[model samples]
Target chain A: MPLKLFELVGRDAARPFSPYCWRTRMALAHKGLSADTIPWRFTEKSVLVPYGSERVPVMLDGDRAVVDSWAIANHLEDAYPDRQSLFGGAGGRAMARFINSWGDIAILGGISPLVLADIPKLLDQVDADYFRTSREARFGKPLEEVMATRDQAVIGFRRSLEPLRQTLKAQPFIGGDAPDYADYIVFGGFQWARVVSPFKLLEETDSVYAWRERLLDAFDGLARKSPGFPV
Target chain B: MPLKLFELVGRDAARPFSPYCWRTRMALAHKGLSADTIPWRFTEKSVLVPYGSERVPVMLDGDRAVVDSWAIANHLEDAYPDRQSLFGGAGGRAMARFINSWGDIAILGGISPLVLADIPKLLDQVDADYFRTSREARFGKPLEEVMATRDQAVIGFRRSLEPLRQTLKAQPFIGGDAPDYADYIVFGGFQWARVVSPFKLLEETDSVYAWRERLLDAFDGLARKSPGFPV
Candidate 1:
């Protein structure tokens, strides 16, 4: 069965990396699962609500609908057991799950404020009225409040980054010698910051950048060069 | 092999039904794993920092140090096969994982503002200096500014709740008739709110309340009772 994936086109200014989408894509590649990506526009998510939320990175295996990145990653892993394993072994499974969650809360939470700093510029490129109205709808706050929230969020991000950067320095990837699901999720967040931010914050960490280089080098050039957004 | 766990008493909040902590506890109940619950005092997450960030609901199984609620829950389901399966069967694992992530981002994020509303009352009950300092550390702004972030978090949560609550109305739990990891994660967040908030937000939904009651009833009086603070 062909795995059909639905994802966003540009990195969402509100949520840039979308570790969830990255995890699914990584799993699809690792599992050797034949999956097609459907590029979705954020404004057009209403069309896909039948599957779940207007969230991108929804996967369809035959008739079964799998939304959320963690679930999709697992389904692909189980569905195609012959491919390279994301979890590696039974012992590694727990570690993988823990790292995935850590990436979501710790890494993504840390990186979000930094990503949002450029949102005003991105909003100018898109629809201004829609951006203002839609953001308030989603966040229930005016632009001024959201901006203040972003500043606070960035402070929180900086605090989290210290320990995380230290950890990255200790190992080649989160899973030690090789890259795995954990690495991919964290990499997605870092990649989002790298590609979207004008300042390029990821370059500060040589170890992290080295890991990103390895991941980019490992993938097919076409997939690597594809105009993909971090769903 | 002995299953291991790391618990920080009132790690997230002091409420009897802290949803974040409950995910780990409920999973332990499901897998029948008896591990130590090290009661954590305020400002003493030094125990967690060496292993990872000072995050709650940590699980150290053998050599692996698993952190975060979703990660620990998934680890338990994957590591323990025979005891009541959190995934149910092969087909259900993906759905279970999705529900887990959905709860983390959508469900938990939705209800977070409401949950945090009680922080002031909770602060009085906790170590005053530590509580205030910790708030400053995580939110990086005054309590008011930190409080504002909830507006967005809650909006996203409410958007996800209708469909989720409807799904629960049709069934006893998120994963259909029986309880699964997803149900527990959902239960944890709401339970935290129910325990802390003066407002009875969960009472509005029968199925959601009933589901909590089921878990409360299953764990007997033991689950319903709070583990009091060390005053």
Candidate 2:
């Protein structure tokens, strides 16, 4: 019996092509666990309201409801310990946990502001002008005027990458040697920036750029292609 | 030989006294491991930077530098199976993971704006006011103004609590039988909020309030208290 995975369709919902969601998908693929993919529409998160968490990449194994990507990934690994897991050994497990934490605190916070850079186009696809109106109302400024605040946000985002950049320069991946939770996390997040963002921030970090390419190639045929979620 | 545990502490750094940090602390306490708490000032995170993550609650077991809380907790549980883990069995483990996810996303996000409500007072305690200044400047509004925008955040936070409220209504804690990771996550977060904000938001949820009172009494003799950092 395959696991059930729910993801939001389209490029990105709250944050486009969220690396967070992709990490779980990658783990499922890595584990060779075929999941019944449930494509979700952002506008109707009510479908998931019963689970009590309004987040994407929720996995249901039997009746178990796992919301966070790392948690879902952890569940997958534990449920099927013999398969290839992001947390394979003692070190790998630690690496996986660390990477997941980094994704939550550092990676997500770093890239979130840029979603506003192309808010008009991003919102147009959703058929909701609420983001524009909300920005205007909240900032008491025009969409463009509020978006003007993104440059400094970009700088701050770039600076947050310094620790990762320095760390990656020391090793091939965050977990050293084999790809673990760290790889999936950094990959999933950076891939969102790599694939979806109008900004090409990964180019600034050559090792990260190379790492992204490697992950894409490694997961090539087995990888769930673009718009991995249901439409 | 006893299991060696590491924690970076300070007056109130980013990694200081967070629910994430306390999760590891409680786990350590449960394991009968007396940890060597390294007090780190905000500027001196450099001491642990070589271990890779700048975050506090980084646990070093031998040479293994486990940087994230979830990872640290898992490491402890996996390494010491005899110890009573918050993750009891597979089912219990899954539930704990779900609750932990809720803490990071909905619970923390819901509580953060309120936490920053007294930024001016927090600024008085810390020698450097850069974080507070930057946070205030980013909000582009007073703490009162930002807090006024919190109706939805409050709603979401409270909604997240409903399941635990329903569960705890029947039991003394979230994990049905005893206090586990779920209880720890819920208790630490709400405890932090109970001290920081006057709003007894959790009070409306009856069973949860009774559970909270019982939990408050559970820690009566423990020296550790969550002082809402820098205040």
Candidate 3:
């Protein structure tokens, strides 16, 4: 059986937008493998219940089921050892965990408030309601209120990218001379923001902007070709 | 010729406090290598002028001069490839750069204000004058004023450490399973703080605090043996 990946999407199934899913998507491309994309909506937890996970980016590799983006990335690397290595080496694998944590907290968490309101617009009525209600409870405010200060909050968001910016100043990618799982780890957050929101998360002059553009152009413009706002 | 390292110190010659220098110090130990430490004070620019750089952690491996902690690390890795690998591989080498950047900006930068005033107390008269003048110029305020809000500002510093904390939650070290350059990169900042200040950077309950303790015990308590304030 062909590998199948449950990807988070909204009204437009073509635009899979979960940051975690994007991480797995980029990892699959890096490994020179392809999976049949199963567009999964936010409110559709029942679809993943059988897989023992409520998250998208759940990968079914023949008989085995893999859940979580990090686990899926590790699974892809181990299962497809002959393909291009997702992690350059064991050291890279360990350090990538730190990058993953930073990406989740600094990148994903930072971008959430900036794009929270824009997200519901991309969802259908039911998914939008679910998204807003769940997110509002998490933020302790309505989506609109959460995003009310985004224009100013985005400044902090951009400032938080200083480590990435400083790193890019010395090397072309986080994986140094070439893009690796570490790059994918961070790019996933940007790709998620681009797919859902029109708000500019990065300035045109920012090195991070150029880095994102390069990733968008990677794999024959795979990410850029995907349906998303022009960020 | 034996390896020589210029280590930043204040009044006490045995106590090296610069975060970048601590990174090199730990990297050297990780490689099972030793260096003759040349204690450097803040006002001692003339001492480094012969090395063609004005920084601590300037390493002289024979006639070759390596400046910057990162450069010194790369130099050590390349020159002593047979030793335990500082970077596990090329991929690790690349990603460690990101960790290095995060260590500098997030960890070191976050701790600076909290410990800024305490630093001068560790310096001699001339060095303290140089430190205050130079640091005040950069911060655009008196060091005391900068540190005045630290009791409150340390909360932000702890929050900024969430990435490291989260990573440590899953792995024993940033290098995973064992300490490596990535661990040294972050531990350097904490070590720097420990050397110069009694300020509590991490609560005893934090996983990061535990991680620091493990590092302190690494290389047979090399870091713990060094002269520093009890943190």
Off by over 4 Å in 3: none
TM-score for each predicted model, relative to the true structure: 0.47, 0.47, 0.99
Q: Candidate 1, after superposition: displacement of residue A6 in Å?
A: 1.1
Model 3 lDDT per residue over B1-231, tens place: 889999999888998999999999999999999999999888889988988898788999999999999999999999999999998999999999999999999899999999999998998999999989999999999999999999899999999989888898889998989999999999999999999999899899999999999999999999999999887
- Tens-place lDDT per residue, model 3, A1-231, is 889999999999888999999999999999889999999998899988989998888999999999999999999989999999888999999999999999999999999999889998999999999998899999899999989999899999999999999999999999988899999999999999999999899999999999999999999999999999998
- Cα error, residue B3 of model 3, in Å, equals 0.5
* Candidate 2, DockQ score (0 to 1): 0.04
- Writing each residue's lDDT as its tens digit, candidate 2 over B163-190 gives 4554553455655455665566666666
lDDT of 2 by residue, A1-231 (tens): 567878755535433355777788778777777788786655556888888777788888998889988678778878889987566443244323424554655666566556544535543455246556655676576756645666677666666555455555545555455455556776776556544445655553466666666676655633325533211
Best by DockQ: 3
Candidate 3 collision pairs: none
Model 1's C-alpha root-mean-square deviation from the true structure amounts to 10.1
- DockQ for all models, in order? 0.04, 0.04, 0.91
Worst 10 residues of 3 chain B by lDDT: B48-57
Q: Look at candidate 1 and give me any clashing residue pairs.
A: A6-A57, B19-B188, B110-B157
**Model 1, residue A201: C-alpha shift (Å):** 2.5
